[model samples]
Target: MAIHRWRFVGIFILLAILGGAAMVMWNFIGLLLVSFAMAYIIYPLAGYFSGGNRKAGRKYLTACLSSVLLVALPVIYIMIYSLNVILQWLIENFGMIQSGSFTEGLKSGLDSAGFGVVSERLGSELGRLISSATDALWTQVTQPTWFLETSISLALFFVATFYFLYEGPRLMELIKKHIPTREKFLHELMSTIDKIFYGLFIGHLLTSVIIAGLAAVGFWAILRPPLITLGFLVGMMFVVSFLPLIGPWLMYVPMGLWYMALLPGGTMPGILILIYGSLMLTIVPDFYIRPKLVRRDADIHPLLILLGFFGGPFVMGFKGIIIGPLVLGLAQAIVMLYIEKRHILEDLFKRL
Candidate 1:
């Protein structure tokens, strides 16, 4: 009895410590989850690179390389490219604003519309608003605290990814050993989770690639942007498509409008791109290809999977993309497992 009391006391102390840790590290939870998901998705690549070698050094090397190649490099490139593009656009627009051309044009348009008296006031207010926004943006960018936090988060993410990739198999075995559940039930749960991950990561990634490739071709044929610039833009669109309610249309539509408005004889190409993007980039891949690929691996309904993709982000911001589907998929798995073992459950209930 004394030993049992000590055991209970130990468990209570452990729980308290864990709860405190969770509260303290709450901000990092999303980054860790993302790291785990990335590690899971790229584990196969690490395995492939290992080539049957079970040596610890080989495992570490393969895991590190896989994390860098499959996750880190792409993310770094995207961040740098996006920042450069944004800076260039801001510089050009700032020049225009400083020259008074943009405000003058707006004021002239307002005057022609018979609002001459209000034009000056509106232009002045707009300029002030723009200046305030620019200042705010600069201030945010230059904040040392923000930069430090972001750098730490990114560093933790990469380190976590590498650790998970190297330790995944052992971690799974440890979980299996510790979980006090029937082996069959545990196996089924793991299987269900695996299928969900496959459906979310592999299906979505393939669909994005196909759509982005088509977009790149369409952009080249229609807009005639430089090849390198076209690739970067299309690549950015591919990443952006993962966000809820924003997809390739975020790029193509704006480009189409710019082409129609700014360039002579550009109307037909712009119209063609809008039509092409609607059919090829957005409609077909989203409705048909994505669903088909997801359903191939995940036994859950495609509509539910789609809901997870869109709804996860809505509920949990960016991380919802993985977490939302995972939660719903786990629920589905539990229901199916219960159905499969209803008789056993019924007999147990009767005994109780």
Candidate 2:
């Protein structure tokens, strides 16, 4: 027992040292991981298609892929279209509130509210800010095509995903050849990642989509930006929304700022006040509901899940959110493995 415990500590120390030494080789490690994550995601899809066999499986495989392609292609097209429309809208209205009359009116309103001195300070700040912002905005407006081209990452992501699905089994077997099988480490690793990727992580992603859809409709009905575009933007924030304060707040702050900025000049001040006041009341309920919905369904501790999420970025680089839970899952699996090993060893010793 003592020797085993010391061996565990020694192995942990050795791993830490090796990991630190490998930091310079991070890019190569990153590519390898991306391939693994992609293959891991795809293997099940292929298995589902192949029916775990070489016969009578290609037809099911084709049918599955056809269905996926049918839905995915149109959705991607619409997202691109909506993104273009919203970018155009912002370009058209970017400078609406930067004129002198608007500033003077805003100052007068602040004066009436007993914030005249504060308003002057804000006016100076606004002047400096808008000057920089306007230049940036003009550059962005003139390059809408460049903006669209940036979505190529999304294209890469889905394409990689598709290839992973098709070629996963061959890839995994190849990987197993390079890794040891004495501990079934590859199987254990996959088992851990499968739960994190397909279980809790997928649940959060789906929930983010639902929340964004609901929010866009709610905001459009009330605040009324380019409805489809705003919904899609907010929906996409699910990518970052789990991070707290920074995530959801990033989307909402813009929603409010734009609500006022885009309104009629005569009413801009009134709208700004209303927007801020309503957000102060509504934002709490908005963020509070999402976690409750997700955690309740997953039956996982919120703190546990949150810690896993924060720890993900540090450990797994970009894939940490998916990888974080896998790390935790593997830790649990390792503990179980050790316990089983201890039991078998004890039984063998007694028989001897």
Candidate 3:
């Protein structure tokens, strides 16, 4: 009994040590998880190009092209373009914003718009927030360690993402073979993931691009928002509009208010167009494009998409935006399938 007790304590000690080690290495683990998610999102296209193990050379080429064109370029473009727009906007408006009269003008405009109390509160909050952010930004810029760490993380992320995309299929096959689940259940799970991700990654990508272009053009043509800055903002909103407690309405409402402030006299037509344009961009994509594309590709219900998407971030944080819905959909599907296979409903009805 004494020897057995010693063995048990030793085992737990070893387990605790391993768990501590894992916790220390969690950032790298998280990066790998993110890489895997990205690779999974693009895997279907990679598989299509591979085409039944035609040639390794062909597979590599296709993966490279897909990663660059679909993932890399759009990301680079959004970041660089958005940064330039921000810098320019700041340079143009920095002095104006700092002026006392400009603050008074803004307050008067807010008063006119029936937001006097809220505006006062918001102004103080924004001032404090901005001051803190400026200090943080300066510290980060001056800190060599922060820059070095950031660079290393980015390097690791890209390298991991590349390899994951390039060799994801073989790894997946290995994983599936080793996964300790019945073949039928495993197949069902994979099927669910494929359907969910296909709709999520590819469908959302195309829809966001279309909506972004539409928003940029509409703002430029109708409301005449500073094309470069506001255009990018409107477009970026769609990409992240699915986030919980956030949406395009946040951006558009402020934008509409600003438009009114800029031209309080002749703003009625622009306001109408802004309203109409907002509806076109926000409503059409959520209702028509996303559902249509997702359903066409995955044959999943639109309600699942809504629940998984909007409800995901609340439960899962940013990544939960994808994983949350996927988990929910998978669980729901698996339960339904299990019940159907066992005649659970029929048995319950008979009992009733």
lDDT of 2 by residue, 88-201 (tens): 765664566455554565667656655547987776666567656666766765796866655664555456555555555556567767775544544555554455554454
Best by TM-score: 1
Listed in order, each prediction's TM-score against the native is 0.68, 0.50, 0.65
lDDT of 3 by residue, 183-220 (tens): 45556656666766665555664565666677776766
**lDDT, candidate 2, at 65:** 62
Could you give the candidate ranking by TM-score, starting with the highest? 1, 3, 2
Determine the backbone clash count of candidate 3.
0
Candidate 1 per-residue lDDT, tens place, 104-128, comes to 8777766665565998898778877
What pairs collide in candidate 1?
none
User: Model 1 Cα displacement at 294 (Å)?
Assistant: 4.8
lDDT of each: 0.73, 0.55, 0.64
Q: Which candidate model has the greater TM-score, 2 or 3? A: 3
Q: lDDT ranking from best to worst? A: 1, 3, 2
Model 2: colliding residue pairs: none
Q: Model 2 segments beyond 4 Å from truth?
A: 1-57, 96-148, 169-187, 218-225, 232-352
Candidate 2 least-lDDT 10 residues = 293-302
Q: Which stretches of candidate 3 lie over 4 Å from their true place?
A: 1-21, 44-58, 80-109, 112-114, 178-182, 199-210, 220-232, 243-262, 265-280, 283-288, 296-352
